[model samples]
Target: MSRRTFSVVVLDSLLSLATKLQSGPMPEPRVRTAGATRGRLWRILMVAGVLAALGGAALVVTVLIRTPEGSAGRPETAAGLPGPPIPPAGTDAVEPSAVPTTRPVPTLTLPSSVATSASSRPPTTSPSAGRGSSTPESAVVPLTARYTTSSVTAGLLGYHLDVTITNPAPRAHTDWRLVVTLPRSTLSVSGVSGATATQDGAAWTFTPDDTTSRVAPRASVTVSFNVNGATLLNAAPTDCQIDNTPCTT
Candidate 1:
């Protein structure tokens, strides 16, 4: 039964017992009034004892029902009876709420133009790769010389000719030579500079010296000589060549 109902029943039984004792049936008039008195007192004491016993039993049962099992007298909260448990502060207790530790990293997207440029870019290669002693077909040597003559003020010389050699290749030419086939009947030549001159018949070959040995890319070198003989006013050297390539004046 509910605690309230149980308590009311017990209280009602105790009240009824007290009322009966206060107004008991009139005892029969007997000659020994002392015997009647002792008997009445004994009955009242017996009823009191029974009431005390019942009260004690009710208290015990109420405690047993109210107390939760295995709670050896911990503090009780009086919400009519006592048994809700609160978790203690420790790692063993389950967490009510927690943040997730692992998540996927956010991806940053590039613009379409940037992505296309990156993907379409060519990969770089080493400059020395596939290159050796042989020059590639595109790197041909374009060597030429311009022969111009000026009349010498001194009568001893017929002409002062300047042979300017030009190198148009991308790289320097370490070795180069200029061969000039002079006009027939040309007198002995002199005042040559910038080269070691050698002649075979009408041809005069000029091999570059240390100073002019290396012709830098897109650069020029000049060798001049004086010819002391008859020649046309606009005469230029014949069979002229720098290295093996013929250089037309």
Candidate 2:
């Protein structure tokens, strides 16, 4: 029977036995009824004690039968559910996860004596203003040219100039030109080498020949030209330019 039914049956039997004990006894002379009444009451108490013991035993048996074999001594939670197991004796407790720490910014050091401030850069010359292409200023290569005197003939005072054209970009540049202005007092002009030569009055323009047509990436090409009437003492070339870039001595 269910727990409630079993408890109810035990209670009903006790009540029934008590009812019979009271029903069997009736009124008599005071002294006589007193002894009988005492005996009847003793029997009722004895029967109640026996029934109570039997009921307790039945309840214990029912609990043992229903419970799992090894779970009798296990502790239950407040809600009657099993809790997480406790670590065994001598076992280490689990450590909590570590929290990440923020790193500090790097320190920058500079010369203490020098003050720092933002200043604008002097504007770079554009190609178009210097007889160069109409290409956008950003697309123009930052070319630079320089010349040195390679040789000088005694009588004619002929000057062989080694003009170096530097291609600053990382790609080939073609159809390059070099322009040089000689002194107006020059006696006679000689031919140019390394490039095709042309003249407009005092200005001598040299276009690239087939062999010197392209300037390789990040390289310098030397173009030599012979000029007469330039004295050894004073053989200065003025306004020398390659692709509109001014030539430095």
Candidate 3:
């Protein structure tokens, strides 16, 4: 062989060897890339599994918490615990006849006297003056008087009399003399004498010179007088007056 052809063949052989080395597989780089890709996929799958397990555990807890006990319909006692008691039947009720009844009581009343009075003298003259004497205008005059009976029993033997006398004048009345004449049908006088009498002739007067009577202005006098029951029952008066003028009955 020629020397130049041999040199050319050796150089061509070296260049072909270099090209084959470069084209061959690199195991370290390929392995590293594959492992990194697999690791990322595994981490993603692990995260998904953890989220699903947490969601399932939460749903289970919610169901358990919402459930209620089965024995909630029982009755409770005052002590806050369950109890059983049988109520009384209709036979235990009370009947109308078992109740008690009450009665009303009546009240009684007795007879009482309403009013009484007495008087003496002529209708127009003062009892202190004689029949022909001239009387001053300011002198107190004594005149015929009357009395009335009230609230008296028809046939009562004894009773009480409430006498009220009112003074109408502005001045206080320091003395009063009253003579009460009883009817002949009810009372009888024992003493017999010729007495001074007025023209009316229906009544008599007995004046006692020892006692004095008086009344105050704009005031009233209430007195309890005692008289014979038989006389008053038979000789009840119908009218009352003071000094020949009509007074309260």
Candidate 4:
């Protein structure tokens, strides 16, 4: 061989040696590198998915916990969301079943002395209010009688005198009579009101008529008579008596 060709062949051998040293080993295939890259991408995606799933679970738990705080014992909606909170029942809004109802009771008030005052009413009066002649006689009731000349008028004979008899007793007299003494020659009997008159000599007895049978406690009765003689003009009645008792003139 020539020297230059030997040198060129040696130099080419050195370049090949250097190239082999720089390359070291053979590079992997594109299919293997692509497969490895796909495996790394798959692993990263799985980790991200797991983290997202954990975050979703945490959010769900938070929602459940918060939901119970806002609306305790409330049912969930169709969308898995919590419903609105329910307010406590107020006093005015309480149901009839929750509270018992009672009827109002009536109260009665009476005076303190009602029993005593009722027992102290006035006593009832007796059934027989007045004393009658037929009544079983009791003690004589205190009484007084008076005679008065009510009126005097001149007449053909002489004068006529109207006399009134009054009873001052506090009780009634059912039967009454009056006796009067006068000059028979001067006075003559005439029509009498509310009584009957019977004369015998100078004494005259007057008995009560139907209307004057009962003399009220504080009442008066009248009797009238005429005088035939003129001697009665200045003369006065002699004496008057009632119930056998002397009477005042």
Candidate 5:
């Protein structure tokens, strides 16, 4: 039974017994029997004992129901229950977020001077020497030179003649000579650089200098001099030869 209900029943029983005892006339000292007296006293003592036991039991039950298990006088949760266990401070329950991936940076750099020289230079092709009727018709001349003339005036005197010789051959020429003949015989000639210059009156011949190495293919060398005391005529050199073969200027 509920604590309130039990308490009310005990209170009502005590009040009723008190009222009966208080209202009933004093048991006549002469008329009252010993057995009856004993019986009445026993009844009162039994009722008091029963009330005390029931009240104590009601208090115990109330305390047990009102106080939660394991609470130990502490405050309870919203649902009147304990909370779930939490992870430790350094626990792995929470993982770090993944780092964002980054693309590598591209670089744009200019080529070095040496690299530029190497790559910018034209590629060389091997030459086919020795004449052969069996050779392909598309075969090109092994050696060739390009000639251009530039004149510098010396006022009333002759002009300066500049000769530029180029080797278009695919292979290097170890020993080479350039021969040029002038139509007029009056002009004087000086020696040339990068080559030894010799003149036989109007005929001029230039040979590679002993100190110089072989002439590289596709290389150009220039020789120039001032021609004085005569008006230079026919600046173009004729009958030019490279190595042993006649070269097309």
Candidate 6:
């Protein structure tokens, strides 16, 4: 108990006490402050969780409102439903098939005389008519003319005729003549050339041209003449001659 020593001893005791206090349990004020801070943090976390849940609910409601009610019956979008099949190349789209129909045909017949004559005769020539009269020129040699008449016109008396000259010889003929006699009063000549004409009573004579008178063998030339007669005269001649030779008479 000296004064300085006593004071020093008391100071040491105070220091030990402060150290003990620091190492001991927390003070009431600090613990309360910490509790208050923890409470505030917990409240903030709960509020954030609630807000997130509300936002999720709002999104679900929007989706439900946007979806169409009728879409349920149609094919599903996300289920990967298949589309209509495509048609094969060059083929038409599938459709119902159709039925078919059918039909028939016809025929013809000919006369017996024509059939028999046609069959018996040679294809190119006429049959001999009688005995021994040296086969007529047509039977001796086959002669043909392309046409018997040259020029034709439609008229009141129908049509007129001309003479056709045919050269049945193998060589070309330089001279040709045709003499046609008809009743002069019954007919009138509208045009004539390179011909000599004369009349004897009702009959007239026509002498053919000698200048341009040339025809090739197996070929023919036509000379026209005017005629006045029946309307049926417009028909073409069935018999024709080659040179002086008659193919058919």
User: Which model scores highest in lDDT?
Assistant: 1
- Encode model 6's per-residue lDDT on 43-67: one tens digit a residue: 5675566556556655655665566
lDDT of the candidates, in the order given:
0.74, 0.71, 0.46, 0.64, 0.61, 0.53
Across residues 69-187, which tens digit of lDDT does each residue of candidate 5 receive? 46575655666677966788887686678987998899877669878999999999655667444445445435444444445562346555555666565556566676766655676
Clashing pairs in 5: none
Clashing pairs in 1: none
For model 2, residues 83-182, the per-residue Cα lDDT tens digits are 7878899999897888869788898876544433322345677555565445453575767888887563563467677888888776688888889887
What RMSD does model 2 have? 20.5
TM-score-wise, the better of 2 and 6 is: 2
Query: Candidate 4 lDDT, tens digit per residue, 115-159?
Result: 678778888867575655543445456345666553344333555
Q: Where in model 5 is the C-alpha error above 4 Å?
A: 1-141, 210-213, 232-239, 243-249
Model 3: per-residue Cα lDDT over 8-87, one tens digit each: 45455555554554466423323556787776676567556655655555565556446532457434557676575554
Give per-candidate clash totals. Answer: 0, 0, 3, 0, 0, 1
Q: How far off is residue 153 in model 3, in Å?
A: 6.3
lDDT: worst 10-residue window of model 1:
229-238
Candidate 6 Cα lDDT to native? 0.53
**Winner on lDDT (2 vs 6):** 2
Query: lDDT of model 1 at residue 41?
Result: 78
Candidate 1: residue 130 Cα off by (Å): 18
Using Cα atoms with residue i matched to residue i, what is each candidate's TM-score against the true structure?
0.41, 0.42, 0.28, 0.39, 0.36, 0.29
* Angstrom error at residue 114, model 5: 62
Candidate 1 lDDT:
0.74
Evaluate model 1: give its TM-score.
0.41
Evaluate model 5: give its TM-score. 0.36
Tell me the spans in candidate 3 whose CA falls farther than 4 Å from its real position. Answer: 1-154, 185-212, 229-234
Backbone clash pairs for candidate 6 read 166-243
